[model samples]
Target: MNKKYIQCIGTFSIALPLLAAIILTGITSIVKAHLLGNFAESKNTYKTEQAQIAVLNELKIQHSKKQTQLKQWNQLLTGDSFTKVNERLRQSIADSNKTKTLQLTDAKRSTRPTYAVNAPRSACEFKLEGTFSEMQRCLTKLECRMPNLMINTMSLNSQINSNLLNLKLNYTIWENAQ
Candidate 1:
């Protein structure tokens, strides 16, 4: 065989694999770029959209829970449209005070064995015949131990018959909605 022909055959042998590798690399690059483009678009459009929707759903859930809590607090702070919550609280406290713990001051209202709030709902008024110290302690307990209690008015007068003082106290209590 001629040396020139043999040299040409050797060159073709080396160039064949090199050409194949280049063509295959180009095809793979094109295929990867095509698939990556679609993936990137879906990740930005569909995946992000789904995540945003989920965030909105969570926000709505939390908003509703907060709204419910707000309504309950409102009910506690203000009982109904007609009557004030503090007035009702006062009546309930007065009723509770009317128990045997306190002696009646105004015999007319005290004659009844009931604690009442006159506003078709509640009020706070009670009479206690005792030393000033006892009444003060009771007021402190109401302000501290109880959740929401407001003392509206108090009248302390010395009794002639007894050395102790006569106390006419009025307070309020707030009942919160669950």
Candidate 2:
């Protein structure tokens, strides 16, 4: 009876330790899985935020570029009076005719509605006879010399019996409101 009692005690001690070890291992596995899930979720959130930041940065760069372009255009605009602008326009036309391949047949000017509260607008229509190359050269010269002039429309028609092309050009200019 004494020996049997000792054997039973030994078996109980070993089994108790084994059971406790198994429970501890299960708890540790569950905790490890939970931690891994949380880590993965955090990584995804970080990536999403980084992508949004990149997009916002790109937008800022584009805005800066647009602002610079606007500044350059504002500097290019002429602030001359209407009479001075007309004189300059006549001079530009004369200068373009140095090659003798272009001729201005008619020119008309009229007041146009203000495009902005601080800027007044005027329109000009020009009828010209020239070769295509000469007309293009004249247009380029005019635009370069008069930065405030914006070409609104243009039409070209080839003459029936001549090598010259008829050109009708319409443009607008902005002036200081004051």
Candidate 3:
């Protein structure tokens, strides 16, 4: 009886320690997986923020270019300067007309500014009846001549009974504020 009791006690001691070891291993594995998942999420977040910063820096550079262009377009708004700009615009139109045998039907010019900012702009609106190619060339020439010209709006419509297209062009040129 004494030997049997000793053997049973030895077996119980070994079995108890083995069961505790198995439970501890399972808990450790679960904790390790959770910690690794958090690390992966943090890494992804850091990368996304870095990309956004790069885009913002690029936008800042573009903003500086725009400011420099504005400075280069400063004007004193003299009568002679206005006449020159107007003559250049008319010459551009005439060249386009000669290129494609088209004519300007109606034209309007206004010194009223669309934006009431530190720099004011004069606007001209032209209505032309011609083929699409002719009107496109006209616009290209005007843009080339006046690099500071802003195309505020443009609309094209096909004439009711003819193959010709009706083009409306609204353009603005900036002037310095004194």
Per-model TM-score, in order, reads: 0.34, 0.48, 0.48
The residue pairs in collision within model 2 are none
- Give Cα-based local distance difference scores for all models: 0.59, 0.76, 0.73
**Tens digits of per-residue lDDT for model 2 on 107-168?**
77755644545556777778889788877777787677667787778899999998999998
- Taking every candidate in turn, the Cα RMSD to the unseen true structure, in Å, is 11.0, 6.8, 9.2
- The alpha-carbon lDDT assigned to residue 5 of candidate 3 equals 88
Give lDDT tens digits, candidate 3, residues 1-178.
6999888887788877888899999999999899989989989998999999999999999989898665544432434344555576567668777545566776778555557565656777777788877777877886775676787888989989888898887777665543
76-146, model 1: which lDDT tens digit per residue?
Answer: 54554214433432443454553334444441111212336432223445666755555565556545444
The ten-residue window of minimal lDDT in model 2 covers: 76-85
Two-way lDDT contest, 2 vs 3, winner = 2
After superposing candidate 2 on the true structure, give the runs of residues whose Cα lies further than 4 Å from its correct spot. Answer: 1-86, 111-118
- Model 2 compared with the native: what TM-score? 0.48
TM-score pick, better of 1 and 2: 2
Model 3 superposed RMSD (Cα): 9.2
Candidate 3's C-alpha runs over 4 A off are: 1-86, 98-100, 111-113
